[model samples]
Target: MLPLFPITLAAAALFAPAVAGAAEPQARALQPLMAAEVAAGAPGVTAYVDDGHRVWQGAAGVADVRTGRRLRPTDRFRAGSNTKSMVSTVVLQLVGEHRLALTDTVARRLGPVLPYANRVTVRNLLNHTSGIPDNATPPAVELFKGDPFRRWRPEELVALVADLPQEFPAGSAWNYSNTNYTLLGMMVERSTGHTLAQEVERRILRPLGLRDSSMPLHEPTPSGSFARGYSLDYDDEYNQIPETLRDVTAHDSSGYFAAGNLVTTEADLARFFRALLSGRLLSPALLAEMKTTVPTSYGPGIRYGLGLFFFDDTPCGTLIGHGGGMPGYENQFASTPDGRHQVGIMRNYEEAPDAVTEAQGTLWSKAMELACAA
Candidate 1:
């Protein structure tokens, strides 16, 4: 077993000021579970879960390993691929308002940019059925390794994968590709005559009063106090070069573009998903379309529906949310299908032990445990 960080002043800070639900006796266990995450090798972890009536926030581990600053429950972090849900929500909103159509082919909007744009439709892009090859090129990875702060344009990222062969015939099957969301971002820009960030702010953030959430674009650092992100140094082949961890808290997220560049706190994420599922965000018909899912490549019982993921077979009934991972950060979020219960989890360190799946499984089980409890 890995050495666990004791509940020092940094960890003890949470047990005092943390929110706990009076009706949720089981919710009190969240802190111990988060401590287990640190014992399992996560540098720091924060979790927030709301059961509609009560909200509980838990933190365990240091914000910085060197300085031993206690992790703030409100601290923001790179939301990574969680940005996909917001982008897709905006596009679907546009679809509902007659600004765009799901059947609209990418060629109709961006013919010159993507080689196979004609064969792919907006619906295909939203559902990851576009079969667009991923742009996570070796060169890009090398660049990330060499200079984590290197800025990138969405077009520049798209150009790198344009000439690559399609993963499969467009719309023939389901495949998770970051390239699909990249195109959606471009489409949003072309359709609205505004940047993706602007549209998201106008349509989602501002209306929901999610003051803590913002798309960082090329900005390498977040606005307020944030937990530092760390990852094990690895070579091109993902072979761990050393046991040492590198601080990647300020890594430029432009490389992720619209697909994974959103920064938000757990509260903001919960609020966004709550509003979305409670019928506040989209029309009934449109939200229904968003929930209609197909089996994903992730694993059995895990389905992908538009930008959201449906946990079909969890112990907590079924959940609807998404998971996001970047270089030095990762997050997991899930809520009941009706949005009455929700949980958002964050870990500062991206690298994991060989039992990464097991570590994640523990979190999933914990979320479900809290969700199903009294």
Candidate 2:
């Protein structure tokens, strides 16, 4: 049976606190930050910022249009690849203890189960230069869509990707493969003799006192307060897909595994990012290693370090973060160099206008400028 927290629906009501009573400037600034995506056709969005001392959160649109439930800042949503950052933290902690080496080959740990295991190393997986084919690519998509609720084992998911040809020779270049982190998840399990969820709870979540974050494997509802996810359904003509409530509980956690399978709130996510960047989660050396960059062409200047991306914006300079997308959700969390400021944003519908990313970039730039000014 699923372990459901007994918090009442009234407790969930705590999220809709007196927004009307908020200060005028904050309320005014929040309007564009929350509605920009939806104005571009996104169904809903929630955003939060942590300015080293206090937090600001705002929400727009509906969480469940079918039920007329409004979006809330406290709502929980599947964090997608943002899960990789958290998993990398646990792996680095293991590295700190000498339980594993960054250069350790997978063959030594996974044995005959993995065909090309001999070629990939722990560092390769963390930085996503593994060359391993992403299991979430093709045939696996069939399995996922056919039985969205299916619980997949790590080996099963890895085999799906392993059955495919390598994209490049190991470490020759960078390719973001879900397979890399799924294998890393297994590596964490084997090294610690505990499930990935348990290690996450023991090493990061519990220690940071993140009460609202959860690594739900097969369970649908979270233990405490959370948000409902929504998807857009389109017709033959290219138009805004009508927003429909989604059951994310059926999302195959096994497919995402360590790569992208955790649900959290904005406040908890901000806390985690702050802790990670502040040296509370990793040693200085490991954290430094985690922040170093590899080349990419996706944005102004894109680079991948261990499990996070470093974005170099003309106005904001360098910021560390990870962006994630699933069927009906998109999320981003970024922190400045000193870890004194951070921003997190989540949208319910997958298809938002290209302007959304630009707007996000603009918001980050403005937020940093304001923070630095203060």
Candidate 3:
């Protein structure tokens, strides 16, 4: 199933054959698959597709369930953990500049942010091998449910789990934790004396000509045109509350800061993925480092590289991107290893039922099948 992977990205290009500008017929087939997600209980869905040559976009369902306005390809989203890939890009860029080294420990950059900082290297954090414990557990979710609008700072997020025990010794095993990225975000500011947003803007957004993308760090909802987000409200006990489907479009997400708060459109995300995997965003040697992966606990046969994920055994082969989700939105994007075919899907609702999740998975597979078609 993982026919091409656990191999170098250079060899991967040989398998996928430089994907860009999908065929028109294959591209047009996505609109209906998007509609099927709405029929399965999603408030809305939007997507983007690109082969090296042409770009296509489609959407179905309503942006606002109450107002019944149609979702559009141009709508913005809180691109969740996808922010990790961008932040990882900057960290690697710093590595290429000789300003930062993967071997550098967190304590070297920010003195003892965690009890075990000295032992945790920058590379460990990037690949989720830092042994940092995640604080965003069910109980923490309960805390936020009490005051969904309560404002939080990055310091508070770090402090929330500082005393917790490590998952394992650094580099001994793999566990995904938002705390790793949050610290790296802090290190970026400490190293460059610029906000994470500024670095992302100058180094990534501006350079790639991605005008529709912006990192609104502390803001709850994205500015300009964005789908009003909604979620199936549940208690900390995982019980569906009364009137479960509620609008969480403005919940304060400062806690998600570097880990999940970047906002952009489907089209912008598609371009970012294309440019990144095509080696435009990172130097060849550094890009190879970004793609060097290890197995993860998240799923079977799947692997995680520094900031990206290798989704093994998919219809389109291994997809190299990330997925971000919070209370009210879900964003997933990926591409062929060669950057020849890129796809992104953004929807307004989050935490759907199993039936719906399965349907969404089907939607993704079908879309990739079309995307990888000859």
| Best candidate, TM-score | 1
Each model's lDDT comes to 0.78, 0.71, 0.76
Write candidate 1's Cα lDDT for 1-374 as tens digits: 11223223222333332334534554456656676666666667777777666778766676777676767778888888899999999999999989889999988987767777888998899999898888765433643456767777888888988888878887688888888888999999989999999999999999999999999777767878788777666666767644445666766677788888898999899999989999999999999999988878888888888899998766567899998877668889888988888888888877555443366567667766776564
Between which residue pairs do clashes occur in model 1? none
Worst 10 residues of 2 by lDDT: 1-10
Candidate 3 structure quality by residue, lDDT tens digits, 209-321:
88888888556567887887766666667675532456777766766767876888877787788889889999999999999998898778689999999998877778899
Instruction: Give me the overall lDDT of model 2.
Output: 0.71
Instruction: State TM-scores per candidate.
Output: 0.91, 0.85, 0.88
Better of 2 and 3 by lDDT: 3
- Overlapping backbone residue pairs in candidate 3 total 8
Off by over 4 Å in 2: 1-21, 24-26, 138-144, 233-249, 297-300, 351-373
| Ten-residue region with minimum lDDT total, candidate 1 | 1-10
Candidate 3: segments with Cα more than 4 A from true spot: 1-24, 51-53, 138-144, 236-238
Highest lDDT, which number? 1
> Pairs clashing in candidate 3?
19-340, 20-51, 20-52, 20-340, 21-51, 21-52, 21-53, 21-54
Q: Which of the predicted structures, 1 or 3, would earn the higher lDDT when compared with the native?
A: 1
Q: Report the candidate with higher TM-score, 1 versus 2.
A: 1
Question: What TM-score quantifies how close candidate 2 is to the native fold?
Answer: 0.85
